[model samples]
Target: MKKNLFRSSSLILLVILMNGCIRGYTPDVVLKKDGQPCISIPADEDFFRRQKEFNILGLDIFQTGVGELWSRHYLDSKDHYYVKNQQCLYFNYKFQTNILYDISFFSTEKGDEENRKSTKKVWMRYMRIIKKSDGTLQLLLDKEARDYY
Candidate 1:
């Protein structure tokens, strides 16, 4: 019983510390009149640290990977291990339209070596912000869309 309590406390502490590290950043959105899906990098380091870990682990660990050598790299949101994208974001669903906005970042390290460090774009999943209305919004998850959006 005590052992389980300790584990839970430790996990809670770990989560709190992590939330502290990624708190100061807010992602940017650009509205294009034409309205088609577009993927682009955040153009700075603050966004890199804000990407929420999809399931396995947070992507901020890779912040070390964005050194002088790389400009931006491709991140496939479909991979679902690192991208901060969540399918059913509810906070601002009502205010949004059908157009999707792009949120981006990448890079990292492990032990004494680089994990997914890249100087050029690599194939990764895109974190998109699609509008709730406009009928143009299509879900990659299909039926699962109703649960969230």
Candidate 2:
């Protein structure tokens, strides 16, 4: 009986540890126009630090660049994140009327300057903003489109 109890406790501990490793948060998405979805992702220190991990662990390719041209022009100067609220990263899609889309975010790192710029432009073409019924926006990676690219 003691052996069985020990096994059960070990199993429970394993499950707890596994659960703790799973990291992700539901982003608040909002639609500002007919086809434009704005995604608000956590930009806190913890979230920012986990970007590489998140990209490696998730299906979507996560990178930062300047937002859409129109949105970039209207970004809030007072906010640290700028282009949106504090402690948040704003992702907006441009040319909603057209079937094709272009997305952007500000790069937070500077290593490998030339390579980063080339890769940044390539990845931008794969991202798209999707709006949910609840008025929140989602950032999605178009794997099919990426494959073609």
**Best of the candidates, lDDT:** 2
Rate residue 63 of model 2 by lDDT: 23
Global lDDT of each candidate: 0.31, 0.35
Tens digits of lDDT, candidate 1, 1-149 = 56655654564355446444423233333333544323323445335665433322222211111211112322444433333332221111122333222222333321212333222121123233355466455433222322343
Off-target runs (Cα >4 Å) in candidate 1 are 1-16, 20-22, 34-41, 46-149
On TM-score, the candidate that comes out on top is 2
Worst 10 residues of 1 by lDDT: 61-70
Residue-pair clashes per prediction, in order, are: 14, 7
Per-prediction TM-score to the true structure, in the order listed:
0.22, 0.27
The CA lDDT at 62 in model 2 is 25
Candidate 2 local distance difference test against the native: 0.35
Residue 131, candidate 1: C-alpha displacement in angstroms: 12
